[model samples]
Target chain A: MLSHQLMAGLGLSILWINALLIAGAALRELAALRARRARLAGPLLRGRVEQGLGPDRAFATHTVEQVGRAADVRSGIAIHFSDRAYRSTIHGGTLALADGSRHTVPPSDDARSEVWIAPTEADAPPGDAALERAWSEAKQSRGFARSLDRSIREQATIAVALPREEGEATWVFDERFARDWLARREGLAALFIVLELAALAGATAVCFVGGSFESVVTKVGGALCVAWFLGVQPIGVALSEACRPLHRAPVRGAWRRP
Target chain B: MSAGTATHNAESRIFKHPAEMRQFGLVLTYLALLFAMVFVPATRTLPCLALACALSFLNTVVIHNHLHQGMFRSHSLNLAWRCVLSFGALYPASANIPSHNLVHHHFEDEGQPDWAAPERVGFKWHLLNLLHFPNVAGPHTFNGVTRWAALYGREDFRRQYTREMVFAFGLTGALLLVDFWATLFFVLIPQLYGARCILRINLIQHDGCDTTSDYNHSRNFVGRLFNWVMCNNGYHTIHHNRAGLHWSDLAKEHEREVLPRIDPSLDEPSMALYLLRTFVLRFTRPVARAVALAEQRASVPASDLASRAERRQSIEAELRAAP
Candidate 1:
């Protein structure tokens, strides 16, 4: 009877270890997901680098079309910096046209009027010595390109370059806003890692704490569990990419500044 | 679409043409074989479990690689392998091949433009599971709701969702006739395990995602032990970087980095605690921050796809440029 109990306990331990193996698989899977996210850490739209020191030297715009949206604004145009980009309604800003005439339009009353924004600077292009160093450093960071891409694609176009001295007479949109956002996200990434690990641990603990065939099955059944947890998107992506090759976009390398 | 455009599109896209007859035949064979395997009496649960896990994982990896067109350039051959592996793996076939392969692939992490997300990011958001919620997020209702509505919808719902649900129902019916525990061990547990695995990884992949930047959204981890089990899935950045590269060649394509050893202590947190913490702290806060950051930096000049025509054009252009 004692031997039977011992045998049962040993079997359960093996089962629990198997569950941990599953959990470890989940952790391993996470590595791929992290990779996929890294792939998307930059601008999806391919645009040439507009050479310039600041907005005065280089900025271009495109007219917005008023079709199929809830927003009411009519006049919309895009702006470009070296790597950053934005689209804005021609509202309340001086449009220094190629013809040299400055036109100031009032902000639109339309609900759909979005002031598209990018990170193009007016005084110095990102390639300049001071900006170049910052770019290089930022590139080395895990998520610098992703931050820049988000800022470039979604936010309202800022007038100033990043890492500016406070005294500099530049109408700089706050680039740190995105960095702060990414910082919070980095914390989330860490949390996700922790959560995945815990799930594995929990499953293992449950098997150890509970001595039942169900526990054993759960543990043994869930081995390679960790990999499942981490690689869902890649699996989905692999599925999607495989099943529907027509839909995939070229995954761009995120611009790491360093 | 011009002749040049059609040719370019054909070259760039995964499903350049329709699936061939041999491929369909192979898929059918795989499906028949998988279902037949379930009905087979288990000689021993542990051995079968081991065998099934190994086989299923291998099939999943193979199918995945085939789907990416990373395996072969010949469309017919790619389709043949996809059918064989997916069916052999016992995954619901019709849904993933078409919906995932056709639609989601077409969209590729599109936020507002995706037909999947009618509202984009608004107050009504909750990543829905077949337009409803699952029990997994009971502890973190809102985040669970959002995660389900947002991520799940993107991950599984849109692809083989309807078909999978039906297939699961069919599986349940079939299991009723077979030994309940046998069904549990062989079918239910493995699939459930796989599902959980998918969700966890999916969340992490796009969770702290930067919507604007393409680079930071995904990063490759350099590890050999993990890669061996997952079939070079560790090189995901490179896989995405060159989706056409075969699974066998994935490791060779990317420059590897040194990764830290796995810490056993790190795996100590409970699921409930981890889920709750992620929901309360990670999900809402970091996403908000990323959005805010994008908005702040967006003040610079850039392009916006306001019209469907433009969006399609841009999408097509982006597809053309994709490696």
Candidate 2:
């Protein structure tokens, strides 16, 4: 029946769509974990730089990490610290502090990565809906490009230039935003776990269930399960990227001498 | 006239390039095979259905190319061909104009997001990105198409789009009425699969690429067989840089212009290797794309049918200008 076919497609779409959303949520969680990882850190225990900087170790270490994110540290991201905050430019062992003084930093990758937030005047992207009318009305009142250019150009101050996106990866703010962010993220983490469980359970059942399932359904479901398993292999890469190596952590790095 | 010259002349009259015959043939094969399954139930095997699904996916690609640069020289034939392509993919082919050609080609240029940007999914696993990308992208494309048509679309554009859409769905409806089982298995599955694959192409080609750079904006799959089967879509960096270039000329254009200027990492020897590395073995992670926060930040790309020589000169200028 057409109804049966449509129903099957609908069922498949609903299942797959939820699966995708869950995967997206996991990505966001890792981003949040990373952001949390970037916050204030303890002074390096007894490293050369830690010993050299003495009491200024923690502040310098934290600032350096944040500054790296703002510059060309990552493949594509460049999230410079806000104007008020101190930033640095790393040149191998030497660090050029934002304040103009330079310091020699260690070779280890142990600094915390600051989250990138859009500036005050940054307007969120236009919603994807009924664009024709919105465009027409806007065009009637003022040229679309001209209006947008005027609006953004009119801003009194711009903090970040072109940055990446929102959510865990970039959405910037201070520790005050951290509590609410944590609360919301805790719910998301819970959701992520639940979704993972459900996906595993569903895929397992779909793959292993016997003759009760229509043979065609069994074949299609099994294919989806296998394919999905293949898809998640990058989870390893994502995990490797997100999880800081315990051995190389700032505290551990700081404790050791070069 | 000699038979060879007569045939060549006739072919030229029908198609802008003789190569489009292959695309037209594949579209026919998909439709013919679907009907064969419907009428000749014995022919409806798993392999046959799978072939249908493959052809159906190819149909979407063919339609995408057709939408970009019409294969037929005759305007009427081009419009009629869209109906055939639409029926094969089970959606109006014109939708690609707004969703892919306008929005995607611009690639979040002018502060608008590519509706199908991989960041939309940002799946933990690479494979999941491909699998689930279509679910998000499909709706966005259609919605964008509808909204675009309502605002900027012309009378002919709206009429033609409506006609193509009605032909696709109307024919599918008629098929369902004739034999629901055949329509479901033989037609719908393949159509849906094709639609999904086409949607995945954006993420596959552009994901993790430096959309900001002059040369690194897209990943290119350079496998000869892959390009042959996919009508040279594997050379995506060149395609985006030169949207109006014919599919047949893409390989040569990519070699001469894109291969030199583009980051070597953007070029892949095999799409199969890419799919395995990206979606299966999961070697690469999504490169966090850096786009401007403020609206209207993007510089406009060149006008349509941009010369490859012009792009090369631009790349050279940027390189020379770079500190």
The best candidate by TM-score is 2
Angstrom error at residue A192, model 2: 14
Candidate 1, B132-233: lDDT as tens digits: 111121112222222222221133333333444455556554663564434444554444334334323334333444323422333344456656555666
Best by DockQ: 2
DockQ metric, candidate 2:
0.04
Candidate 2 lDDT for residue A201: 58
> What shift in Å separates residue A133 of candidate 2 from its native position after superposition?
16
lDDT of 1 by residue, A1-258 (tens): 113234345443534444344333334334534543342343222222223222333222222221111111123211111212223222233334334444332333223222223324322224456444444443231112221211122223333221133432112222344334334434444455465456656654554445553544544534434234334323322322222111112222222222
Q: Kindly report which residue stretches of model 2 are placed more than 4 angstroms away from their true locations once superposed.
A: A1-142, A145-258, B283-323
Q: Chain A TM-score for each candidate, in the given order? A: 0.28, 0.31
The residue pairs that clash in candidate 2, if any, are A70-A79, A70-A80, A117-A172, A162-B292, A231-B127
Q: Measured by TM-score, how close is model 1 to the native structure?
A: 0.34
**Each model's DockQ score:** 0.02, 0.04
Q: State, as a TM-score between 0 and 1, how close model 2 is to the true structure.
A: 0.59
